[model samples]
Target: MDVEILSRIQFAFTIAFHYIYPPLSIGLGVGLVIMEGMFLKTKEPVYEKMTRFFVKIFALIFGIGVATGIVMEFEFGTNWAVYSRYVGDVFGSALAAEGIFAFALESGFLGILLFGWNKVSPKVHFLSTIMVTLGSMFSAIWIVVANSWQQTPAGYKIVGEGMEARAEITDFWAMVFNPSSVERIMHVWIGAFLAGAFLIMSIAAWYLYKNKYQDFSKKAFGIGLVIALIAAYAQLVTGHSSAEVVEQYQPAKLAAMEGHWDSSGAADMYLFGYIDKKKEETVGLKIPGGLSFLTHQDFNAPVTGLKAFKPEDRPGSLNITFQSYHIMIAIGMLLISLTSYAAWLWRRNKLFEKKWLMLVFVWAVFLPQIANQAGWFAAETGRQPWVVYNLLRTSDALSQSVQKEQVMFSLILFSLVYLVLFMLFIYLLNKKITHGPWHTDSDKHSSRHSDMATELSKPSSQS
Candidate 1:
């Protein structure tokens, strides 16, 4: 492979791994605010204990997210110098705003949120929690805005010649609110919320299954379920909205996503399929004209297909884009079903009674994470060939001086380092889960004693 391929793979690997945490951090940040707010409103000790326990977990996620995230910025300059220079002026403004509006507020309040428990008044601590949540969300806004601007260039003009060429912001706010930004931002925010909510529910489900901290787990699961329910439905709506935006601005990507090749007819929405690129045919289940109705509210509306673009201009690999997109959609539908069923059970006061359901919740923790990653894979891969829509071809954006060997070596090192980090994360997370929320020795002792009694009452054959 050449430097461009190696660099792309290296960046993709780092970004994908790094992505795991931010959504969790963003999602968990929202959970923290709600948990803390409940404590404030009800003056309940259990709520405070829950808030404190999760705050520790949130800190762990935030620390790793920040650490892993710094590498991407350096990659931009080292691996894709041309790309960096091209978008630097635009990215600079957005990132600067993130530093000022998002990072500053989140970090300043973070200390209070983590360690200000008894030292600060309850109201003050609650305010800090809210600020931290807002900060994380605000952080997402600028990042998505910058990325979306690449998908749909706006309020910018090319201002140099040859290798010195770059885009300069002609209108700052217009650049910030680029055509695709608002929709993408909302889509990203909801995905993060779902990630965080599911993590909480997964942990809570495990606790409930083990018959540990019943009251606390119940409360936590209830809150997580509520958020998951709302976010799941909201994602469906935003997913549609985002798709519409893609249809209008990046139809080739949309075509690649659905594996549609012909421009003479309406597009079919595949439930699942395999694309045979050699034959240029997709075989599997599909709804006739489903995409057309979704995009144009008419079953026979013509949606642009891959045939509309030159072969070189289309997404480089359509199968990857198609599969990634379908995976995301499948997970989204699954989540909606899961949340709706869980809600029904909760309403019937039978949620905790179902071992099967709680078990599903425990494993379902990974679904949102998968969905988030898949969504990004689809978006980025679908935009292939063009790192900045019509403005900059990805091939033209590489750092000419970089070598394949250097990228390969760095990729190996990054893999090893990230493996260690991942192991550490799992170890810490497991340690915390196993420890449970034992505020006092008595609480721990009583919970253990209760577990022993419950076990003793079970059938000996099972034991």
Candidate 2:
């Protein structure tokens, strides 16, 4: 009912929607690099075809991400003017750098990547792919530095006072390497890679299931599966390291994540089930003394609880954080299992024979998207009340002049528009996929990807 609430909802919905595409873009960028790199190294025509197919998908995703992301910038001036003004000095620089150091370079090479495949040399094309991948990562780095600074404010001093106060960066490098930046960015980038890898594997699995593009499917699927397994393991390690950092910097968030409410001694960590927020207790499965062992490797270590903080200082939505954290964990574990099993099947050279796993892989494309969303939900919701952690409460972050009706109207309008956009994306994607990766052998046509090849020898189609 409140204007601030409406504004928050609007920003959250639009940003979340915009977020969906970027990870796919980032992930797909990694996929593109691998595909094109192999094309250069091995002179495989299949790899070239795969690179072209992914280029189309990547371009589409990049277009949508750029379009949707512009809306968030407008919202900063409209819905969060006060918050923007407060941290403008610190945050604006990061965004500015993102544009200059990241977006410009990526966009400049994107033309070469998408269209220059036919016009340029293969080695040159491969170089473009690498640039795009690095650009995506650089974009993520600056944004992560900004957001991580909010979670763990450092390298800044408060200027002025009260309503007129603003944070000014005192040490630039210190701000860049703030306590949570590296860990948070590592987790985010890996998640993006997972999103991309699973998507490729999912599409490849579908082709195999339909008995279409067998050789193409096998190669693409194998590459994606290998990357998925490695990224899955990397995610586990980064998630653990991030948690350790959170233990030191954002203990209240860790408290909410594990659903631990005791003020002292060994704390139980809930693995699943419901949190009784009213009672500050968990109502499901938990590992006894898990919290203590997890954080300190000691069963008797004291973990801070919500009760330790004044009621007003506690995160507003403990239940959301608790549920989101567990949901993320559940999906992450499932992904590890699925990728591991796929690796086993491939090792035996019987992966396609398992129709059950083929079906699972086809549907598994949605898993990384879900897991990525859940992880973010846990992180953002758990850091609530304070938009800038301990320094700035979210209540103080809203635009003073914004009205509830204005935000609500925009929210409704944006939601409807986004829904249509989503339907269109799926429709076009299905159309492209249903047409198959490229022409079959019966067509007697030179492959569409032939232009992308610069090798001394032509690749013979296998199977």
Candidate 3:
């Protein structure tokens, strides 16, 4: 492969490594807020123990996320210098805002959340939990805003010409409210919530199956189940909205997603496929007019195809885009099924007896992580050939100073480094989990009774 290919591989590898933690951090942040809030409201020692146990995991993931993400910023300048200049104004504002508002806020309170359990009041610690969760969400918002602008650029005007051209924001608010930003941000948040919820469920399921921490497992399972269902359903809604936006603004990318080839008439959604790009045919089972119905609420509405665009402008690698998107959708559907089945069983109050379901949850923790990566791949590569959508080709965006060999060397080096980091993360996470929470059943009961007594001793006022 050439320098461009090497650069793409390097960036992809680093980003894939970096991505492993942010969603977990965001998801675990939500979990911390919920568990801590419950502890404060009910004064239950179980909730308090759960919050403390998860905060450690959150801190670990957040630390790793920060370390990995910093390299991407340097890559923008070193590997994609032209792109850096082209969109510097836009990305700078978004990323700077993220650092100032999101990262700073999260890091500031994270200290208190992780270390202030005994140092500060429970109310203060609970407030830290809320702030951390919001900060994680806000981190997601600005990042999505920047990326969404690339997918569907808005409120910006190109200045200069040719090699000197750059996009400058004409309307700051319009730039922030880019066409795809809100939908993408919501989808990411929902996915993060699902990831976090499944992680908790997996651990709880493991505990139940092993006959360890029975009370802890049940409480965690209940909360995780509710959150997973809410997020899973919300994912369906947000995913649909995102597709509609894609149909309107990036029809070629939409075409690649479904392997839709006709320039007019209805689009059929493929359930699965082997797309032969030269023949422009997809060999798969497809719902007739399914895409049209989904996008336009009409079975026969016209949907644009790749043929509508000039060959040069068409997104490269329809197969990669098609497969990645369909796989993401398949995983999403599976998540809904898995969560719904468990929810139905719980409604019958027979969930605990189902050892099979618990076993499934123990392995299903990887589902959302897989889906999130696949979705990310589809979103980025689907808009192929272009770094800034219609504005700049990825080939033109590469650093003139960098060579193929340099990128290749770094790629190999970083891959090995990441492998070590991944192993260490798993080992540490497993160790903490094996140790279990700090509280026993007796300690929990004593705390609960003490809380009740304190509540009873408080003076009642007649209003």
Candidate 4:
């Protein structure tokens, strides 16, 4: 394989693996704040227990997210040195802001959040949770801002120095509010919320199934179900808006996403399809005028197609984009249905007792993760060929000095290490779920020591 292909694969693998954690962390961080805030408000011990139990999981995810994210930074310099230099002026400031305003602030208070539960007052602890949540959100903001600029290429002046083209920031605020940033950030944050919400719902459902900590599990389910439903719904709207923006600014990508070969006034949205790239057509079920209405709010508005662009300017593999976009939308719709059903069950007071439904929830735990991954693939792969759209091709950005053998070796090493880490994460997470939070119940203690120590056992237990 070519070194560039190997390098791209390595980076994609590492990024996709690493991405699994951050959104969860970000989403769970907000859930933590809500849980803790309720504990402070209601003076409920069960809520406090829920907060303590999940805080440990949140910290574990945060640690891994930080660790894995560092590799991407190094890869930018090592595998794509020329690309890094090209966008350094724009990306550097965004990254610097992330460090100064997001990572540092989040890290500073994270220790206090983890260990200061008993050491600090409830008000102070709640404040810490809020700060951590805000910090995580801010971190995402800068990242989206940087990536959005790459997608839209705004607030920058292109400087041609000999053989290289570099971007210099002309307006910092404009860079922060790039055309794609707001919609992208909203979609990202909502996806995070869905990830965190479904995780909580799955775990809570498991606890209810086991008939353990009934009150705590019920409250957790209620919170998770409600938030998950809202976020899933909001995602539909935000995703639609984002698509409209893509259609307007990145017509080639939109064309690939819909597998549109020729321009039409009323485009059809494919529900499912197999694209024949050679034939430049898709064979599938489609909704007529759906694409036109989605992109332009008018069925008769002309939609651009891949054929309108020069072959060199086309974004990426049409089949990949088409499939990824459809899969993402399908999963998103499934989530909406599932979460809405969960909410209805909760409202009827029949949620906890439904064994069959609980089983479905257990299997559906990975839905948000799948949707998140598919959405990312649609966004990134849909905007391919050019790393910075028309401004820079990926091939031109790769490091000229790096050999194929070196990248291949690193790729294999990364895959092995990440696989081990993923297995370890699953093992630890399951162990935590099975063990559950620490309980102070006397019955549990007495059951443990009944045979050996009669004096240490108690007859009555506190609830």
Candidate 5:
């Protein structure tokens, strides 16, 4: 493989791995806020116990997210120096805002959130939880704004030429609110919510399945189900809004997403299919004119296709883009179905009665993660060859001094390090989950242990 391919893979791998935690962190932050709020409103000891338990897990996720994220910043300078220089001013402003507005607020309140349980008043700690959650969400805003700007460049002027060429912000707020930013931000936020909610539900369902912590499990599962059901439906709206933005600004990507090949016509939306790139055909089950209606609210409205763009300008991996997009949609629909049914059962007071449903929920923790990854794969891959949309070709963005061998070696090292991190994370997470939420009731103890409250509530257990 050439330098470009290797560099792309390395960055992708690192970022993809790093991507796992932020959504969980963000989602969990929201959950924390709600849990803590409930404790305040109802003065329920159970909610406090739940909040405390997940606060520990949230800290673990935040630590890992921060650690993994630093690598990508360094990679920008090491592997994509030209790209960094090109977007530095814009990204700088966004990141600086992130540091000031998001990170500062989040970290400032984090210490209080983690250790202030005994030291501070309940109201003060609850305020900190809200602040921390807001901080996580604010962090996402700047990051998504920066990324969305790449997809739809706005309010920037090109300064210098050739190797010295870079984009400078002419209007900062304009750049921040660029065409695609809001929709993309909402999309990402909702996805994170689902990730966090599903995770909670997954664990809660597991506890219920094992006939442990029945009260806590039911309450936690109910909270997760509410968030999941709401977010799942909201995703549909944001997804459509995002598609509309893509159609207007990045028709080529929209075409690639749906495997549309005709130069101009109302496009069909595929439910599932195989794209035969060689033959320029997508053999699939589809709704005829479905995409056209979605994008234009007109069944016969013409949508641009891949043929409208130069072949070299088109996304290189049509199948990957198409498949990843479809996978995201498929998982989303599945989640909506599951959550809706779960909500119905809860409403009927039969949610926990179904052992089969509990079994499914125990494993459903992975669905949001998979969907999040697939959504990212589609967005990034569909915009391929352009790291900064029309402004900078990905090929031209590499650090010319770096060799493929160096990239490959670094990639290998990163993989090994991340593998160990993942293993350690899983081990610690499993240990925490096994410990279960601290409980006063002796009957709720697992077969493997007694006095879970005494064991899990120790100061040392905050890790």
Candidate 6:
């Protein structure tokens, strides 16, 4: 109804859709390195085939991630012109660093990694894979640094310009390692890794269930399960640390997430409940003293509540924040359990033969994606009224000149385009998986090429 509300909706929709691809790209990049590295080590044709098959998939995702991401960058300037101008100096430097250190390096090596199978030596090709993977991670680093600067307002000074104030970068290193950067980056990368690992396991589990490519599926599942388990466990630690940072720096947001209304010592953690903000109490189960221990590592420590601050200063929809956080945590725990069970089965040499379990794994591939989206919702929605924490209100950040109808039209267009792109991606990926690699006869051709070239150059074998 309102222009500001419409603008917020448009941005959120675009960002959420765009987010789906990048984590897959980053996670798949790491998986590609692992697959290719194993091929080099074992000199196995199956491993090489696996690498080639998935690299094609990775290339498609990388392209989509880049394509979708470009639109959001443009929106920053077009829809949120004032916000862009205010944070431009800080954002510009970080973005420039991303282009120079990440995008360029990754793009340069990508062609070689994709097309140099027979043209380059194995060692050289492996080097290219490493570069691409690191480049993806480097890209994430700079982007997170820029976002974290907004969250914590570090490495910058506000300069008064006319009536409004603009931020200027004052300490470059401080900006890179802002208060929230380390925890956020760690949480994000681990989520990416989990997304990639689960994807591989899902496909492999399907193949195993159908009794196709049994050996390949077995190896793929084993490797994927191990990586998934480790990443999920590491995420729990990082998530806790990130929550601690939020408690200290963004108490209102944290208070909203836990549905805390009255400040108290030895707070209770609501395990499953609906909080009636009007009544100021939870409607279901809660674990007393859990919140205090979680936040401060002590049972009787004091934790802030929403009542501590003015009502208007609070972030959006406490119910949404609480539900999203709990759902994400539940999914994370489920991932750990599933992978752990898979690992135990692997140790007993029974994982590949479990038909029901394999089927579950096939469908359960979507769980990590759901968890990833929910986690993002909890973080962004939890931040509420402030676009840059207490420094800038979201209402003041929107472009004054843009019409509501314009935002609505663009939102409709974006949704249709993204839906088509998603369908195409799924179709192409399924085609690649079904058809297998281009060179299934890789072993036969391995020595044939070298021998044929050598003989052809040796005076026509005059004997």
Task: Estimate TM-scores for all models.
Answer: 0.95, 0.96, 0.95, 0.94, 0.94, 0.94
Kindly give the stretch of ten consecutive residues in candidate 3 with the minimal lDDT sum.
440-449
Give the alpha-carbon lDDT of every model. Answer: 0.91, 0.86, 0.87, 0.84, 0.90, 0.83
Model 3, residue pairs in steric clash: none
**Tens digits of per-residue lDDT for model 4, 1-463:** 8987888888889889988998898888878888887776665556777887888889888888888899999999999988998999999999999999999889988988888765677777778888898899999999999999888988888898734878899999998998899999999999999998888888888888788878988898788888889999999999988998898889888998888777955788889988787787778998888788888788766799888988777765678778888888998999999888878877888778798888787777788888888888878888888888778888888998999999999998988988888888888888878878654232253321222223322332231
Give candidate 1's TM-score. 0.95
Instruction: Give the least accurate 10-residue stretch of model 6, judged by summed lDDT.
Output: 447-456
**Winner by lDDT between candidate 2 and candidate 1:** 1
Instruction: Estimate, for each residue in 20-80, the C-alpha lDDT of model 5 and write its tens digit.
Output: 9999999999998898888777655578778888898999999999999999999999999
| Clashing residue pairs in candidate 4 (N, C-alpha, C atoms within 3 angstroms) | none
Task: Tell me how far the alpha carbon of residue 252 in candidate 1 is from the true structure, in angstroms, after superposition.
Answer: 0.3
Q: For each candidate, C-alpha RMSD in Å?
A: 6.1, 2.4, 3.3, 4.8, 5.3, 4.3
Better of 3 and 5 by lDDT: 5
Task: Please give the lDDT score for candidate 6.
Answer: 0.83
lDDT of 6 by residue, 246-329 (tens): 998989888878887778666788887886877766666888878989998887887998889887788767888888888888
Top-TM-score candidate index: 2
Clashes counted in candidate 3 amount to 0
Better of 2 and 4 by TM-score: 2
The predicted structure with the larger TM-score, 3 or 4, is 3
Backbone-clash count (model 6): 0
Q: C-alpha displacement of 239 in model 6, angstroms?
A: 0.7
**lDDT winner between candidates 3 and 6:** 3
* Candidate 3: tens digits of C-alpha lDDT, residues 299-318: 99878987788777777877
lDDT of 1 at 98: 97
Task: Return the TM-score for candidate 6, rounded to 2 decimals.
Answer: 0.94
